[model samples]
Target: MTLNWDNCPAVSRSSDVMSGAVVFAGTRVPVSALFENIEGGATIDDFLSWFEGVTKEQVNEVLEFATSSLAPA
Candidate 1:
């Protein structure tokens, strides 16, 4: 199954914003930042504190979406 990224309200990308970079909705922070920071040992709380506008709920939903997408069909 194809993952419908458009259904993810937590993320958005447009040429008008950050040159079409995939970012958390309402924030300039890229989605990749979350993965990169976590890989660098930054916890969810730390990430939330660092980037305002992105809520825990959005992060949780995004993570869940990604996890589900990676699961075996």
Candidate 2:
């Protein structure tokens, strides 16, 4: 299923912090944390295990949003 920013929970910019390679948007969890886990052979279930507040759908949305934002014209 395709996920978009509109359907996902809002991650407030004010609560986010960018430090070098990491982006932390509230939750005190780096946005990369999700990707890192995935890259390390972790499943969605594993990621959710580490982040109880964020759902599988939200993770997909975050990835979708980030992908679009970073896409080249």
Candidate 3:
């Protein structure tokens, strides 16, 4: 399947995609979920436990996408 960033589910802050909320492109798992897990002393294993469908690669991609979105133009 093709990934379309435009259709991806995202939350914005001040019209900036970087400062906004980001959920799974298709699923409802918020990118912040991963951060929340780590902040709560949850390991990678624990994060996967809560979001079985999310992969480590996906988490990385989300961060990368967010970074690019915020990069100075």
For model 1, give the 10-residue run with minimal summed lDDT. Answer: 1-10
Worst lDDT run of 10 residues, candidate 2, spans: 1-10
Q: Clashing residue pairs, candidate 1?
A: none
lDDT of 2 at 19: 40
lDDT of 2 by residue, 1-73 (tens): 3223333353433323544333333454656688788899998888888876776666776777777766876
lDDT by residue (1-73, candidate 1, tens digit) is 4456787888998999989888899989888899899999999999999999999998998899889887989
Which candidate leads in lDDT?
A: 1
Q: How well does model 1 score by local distance difference test?
A: 0.89
Model 1, residue 73: distance off in Å is 0.5
Model 1, position 39, has a per-residue lDDT of: 96
> lDDT tens string, model 3, 1-63?
222355333422233444444565444566678767878998877786788677777766665
After best superposition, candidate 3 residue 5: deviation in angstroms? 9.7
lDDT of each: 0.89, 0.61, 0.61
Give each model a TM-score: 0.90, 0.58, 0.51
Candidate 3: global Cα-lDDT?
A: 0.61
Candidate 3 regions with alpha-carbon error over 4 angstroms: 1-21, 63-73
Off by over 4 Å in 1: 1-4
